[model samples]
Target chain A: MSVPTIKFYVREGLLPPGELTSPNQASYGETHVQRLRLIRALLDVGGLSVAGIRGVIEAIDDPRRPLHTVLGEAADQVVPRYERGDGSGIAEARKRVAELIEARGWRTYEGSPAAESLATALAALEEVGHGRFAEILDAYADAAERVARVDLEYVAHQVAREELVESVVVGTVIGDAVFAALRRLAHVDASDRVFGETP
Target chain B: MSVPTIKFYVREGLLPPGELTSPNQASYGETHVQRLRLIRALLDVGGLSVAGIRGVIEAIDDPRRPLHTVLGEAADQVVPRYERGDGSGIAEARKRVAELIEARGWRTYEGSPAAESLATALAALEEVGHGRFAEILDAYADAAERVARVDLEYVAHQVAREELVESVVVGTVIGDAVFAALRRLAHVDASDRVFGETP
Candidate 1:
């Protein structure tokens, strides 16, 4: 980004500019520059507004707290509470899903969406069969929730507040990207597993 | 999303409407409808465009693939290869980060931004001497990568083809949203941890 853009960020309290050397020329150290660039990427590439970016930047700059604390806060911003099935055949589905969550050892709330999605899937599955969909999907949802917790813990270990936020945003998107890429790689692995130059 | 929007999607080949029941009427099954809604959320709310969204949807629709493939590709896209500092003080920082990633047992390519970010952070630590910024972040990255792998495995277990694509889209955005929300909850937990509850 341009120095003027950096200057604007400084003026907006989005960044802290380093000491000025002269009337017009000012020196920027690495953190200042790095923070500036990161903020720009989060704001521009990531499409966050200044205020949202500011909140993230401030969290990153703050040192008194542990990084996980900030990451947990960021995670909360994104996860929605899933509730399942209205009075429509969804009620039975919801119960089965709740059972699945319970079986997985997750504490499902009154109106969690994972539970709800499960319920919806259940209702839909009823059309297919009682035995097939219920047990398997519940297991998957439980696993998904567990994985999410692990993802958070991983965030705690790896990133400061700013990077944590960036990672969650980028990771979630890139996770899908990587998932697709790896799936292709897996095929290559499979093909190699089968016929092509097996080691 | 509105029916017209669904029509627009059908026309765009992003979603295919279900069987036509009469001359002017068509019936969309729950799955088709749900898929369309998920697509709308990703494209509109998540800010993914037609082509970007299409890549994701196509990735999901490919049941023969796993999510790790897609996520790996996405990571490569967003976190591009970055040049390490050339004889600059920043280079020292980069070297340290590379070492740290290696120490953490992560596979660090020489020119990746993730590697560079770690390097830059290490350089900062050299000057700052490890308070808020330190070597622990490398550990966190390692953990984050593991968590991502786990998430991909979970997705792999449950979905493929159109469902895979839909799950990827919803799961990707929702994972971010869920964590962000959880992060908020953690803040509340932090607040409770720090400041006692009101009488």
Candidate 2:
């Protein structure tokens, strides 16, 4: 990380300032290094904005919040909020998302950010004449549930609360990238099988 | 989308020019509208860059290329190429990825984009002192395989090759967003179940 970037993170309250040990020099610790890496991962890999990272950092630093709550909030903050216009397509998509959640027996909160993100994606699909794509919602949900099970199991292994929180944040963000890449790889394999192409 | 944005896409050759009826009158057909919506979804939701989307469009528009070839090229183009700087961490991660692929019996190409992307993510995890996260690779790959199965099944329903190519492109890009969102929702539910939090 560059000096200006570190300064910017400190200025934006995404990272804590180094300890002032000298008149013109400050002493940084391992936490600073670790936080900087996390911030870079979130920005570069997670595609989060500075403000979004700030929200996540704030949630992490708050001691009173439960771990799961912080995780939910941080996950929610990463996705950009979409404005719901008078488009009936989005409304219809939102209803489909609700029905999928109900049918799957998923216990998500009302107005879950993920639900909104799914609705936005569904609406875009409809706009492009792929409204029928919603037919695969159950399949996607099944895979998502399996992925989540593994993720939670991994995070559960962390003994430290701080480490646990940080793990969720990092895992949720970078894990998305990891899963996406794997999905693409799997796509290639599946396509090869379907088209009789040699890998 | 805005006029200038559409103009930029047209200038970039990412979108075809609208039909000209007069000197200052141009009419965009359904193809243009659908392409614009796809572009927006890739940009806004999929978080792909202009250059990346351009490469994908190029692959899709090329008739000589086979379907699987186009899918691989498009997937490769989305991930920002990461240069290995004699870093043992990335090297180690790459090796792990190779092992995971072999153990899973997945027939991915050498230096696959997904492998490179996974290495980048793993290296980042190591940078943040979470290198152990690689231990969960099998679980992730399993879920990814299932998701890809469903994705391919959905795309297989498209009888037209043109629609098949478009489906893979759209499904790969928007599908990432859709899956990521669902994963987050699953995380919330999983966390709730694990932590005994009432949803």
Judging by lDDT against the true structure, name the best candidate.
Answer: 2
Instruction: For candidate 2, write residues A87-197 as lDDT tens digits.
Output: 538888889889888887888865788899889888887877787788887888898999899999999999988899999999998898899899988898888899745
Best of the candidates, TM-score: 2
**TM-score for chain B in model 1:** 0.59
lDDT of 2 by residue, B42-143 (tens): 777667789899999988898888888888877876777464343547888888888888887777875887888888888888888888888888888888
**Predicted complexes: DockQ each:** 0.10, 0.69
Model 1 alpha-carbon miss at residue A104, Å: 16
**Docking quality tier of candidate 2?**
medium
Residue A43, candidate 1: Cα error in Å is 2.9
What are the lDDT figures for the candidates, one per model? Answer: 0.45, 0.84
